[model samples]
Target: MASRPSISLWFVMAADLATVVWMYTVGSWLDHTSKFTATSTLGGHHILVLVLAALAFATLAVLALITDGFTNTTPRLSLIKNLACILSVVALTGLVALILASLLSRIVFGRLRP
Candidate 1:
């Protein structure tokens, strides 16, 4: 028989799903809005988006690796890793959201730059 998932598991799943929704919605919104501006550090929207996605992936992966390595070893490390994981997930969610938003913009605004 299959086992039931715990509350924490459900929470995590819900949170992750919410993150995806937020990203897609925000992306759509930003794409339609005319007031948003790009900073020099982030460059133009297209390049900034790719950079954000890459950063999000890098941060989540690194934190996950650290958490995996510390699991079953130390309590302090476990707590720290968990915190880092949470933070990375949030950051990743935001960046990914931007990427998704940019996708909508690209589709509407044209993909090639003149």
Candidate 2:
């Protein structure tokens, strides 16, 4: 008999999928908006949104690590472990991209001053 994938695996997969969709949406929005103006600054709200996205990615990466540790102990669960690894890499990649985008935005717009 074959064993079923755990609930936590499903939860992590769903959450990672949602987070990827959200990051893509925000990235698209940024690209669209950037084309309109040569010099534009991110407002406090925009910064807040970016920060939240980063946190989401970080949280997902941590969850993936924890899930992988707790659930992928048996040889039968190798597939799940691989999937978790991929999800963690994706999350980390998104986090890096977000950080790069923030740095580029700062360079382009200068520092946000009160």
Candidate 3:
């Protein structure tokens, strides 16, 4: 029987897609809404978001390296492989999220500034 994908993988994929969609929709809405104009700075939010994402990616990488599973293991099957796979998923997800968010923001808002 073919085994199903792991939960962490599903979470990572969902999170990546959700992050882009949420950011684009919310950013576009805030840009279009007049009431939020005085309360928030919609400009540069995408950059800020991507920066945060980069930080998160770095954090995950560091955690994976430091965690017990990765520490001086004697060639365990799941330890190194699992950590590496998880990190790969996160990295790819972050890249795709950033690209999609940027593209959608540009298309929807068109050089908006606060």
Model 3 C-alpha lDDT per residue in residues 1-114, reported as the tens digit of each score: 223334473355445444445555564454446443312223425334433434444444453454442333334534544554554454345345546777888999998876
lDDT of 2 by residue, 1-114 (tens): 224546765555555555555545564455346543211113213333334435554554554475563443456445546655564444545445556777899999998996
Tens digits of per-residue lDDT for model 1, 29-101: 4434543422211222433443444444444445346545223325664455456446445434444555677
lDDT of each: 0.45, 0.49, 0.46
| Highest-scoring model, TM-score | 2
Weakest lDDT window of 10 consecutive positions for candidate 3: 35-44
User: Clashing residue pairs in candidate 2, if any?
Assistant: none
Which 10 successive residues of model 1 have the least lDDT summed?
35-44
Clashing pairs in 1: 27-101
- TM-score of every prediction relative to native: 0.33, 0.35, 0.29
Name the top lDDT candidate. Answer: 2
Q: Which stretches of candidate 2 lie over 4 Å from their true place?
A: 1-21, 24-27, 35-72, 100-114
With candidate 1 superimposed using the best TM-score fit, by how many Å does residue 60's alpha carbon deviate from the native?
Answer: 10
Residue pairs of candidate 3 with colliding backbone atoms: none
- Would you list the rank order by lDDT, best first? 2, 3, 1
Q: Give the runs in model 1 whose Cα sits over 4 Å from its true position.
A: 1-72, 108-114
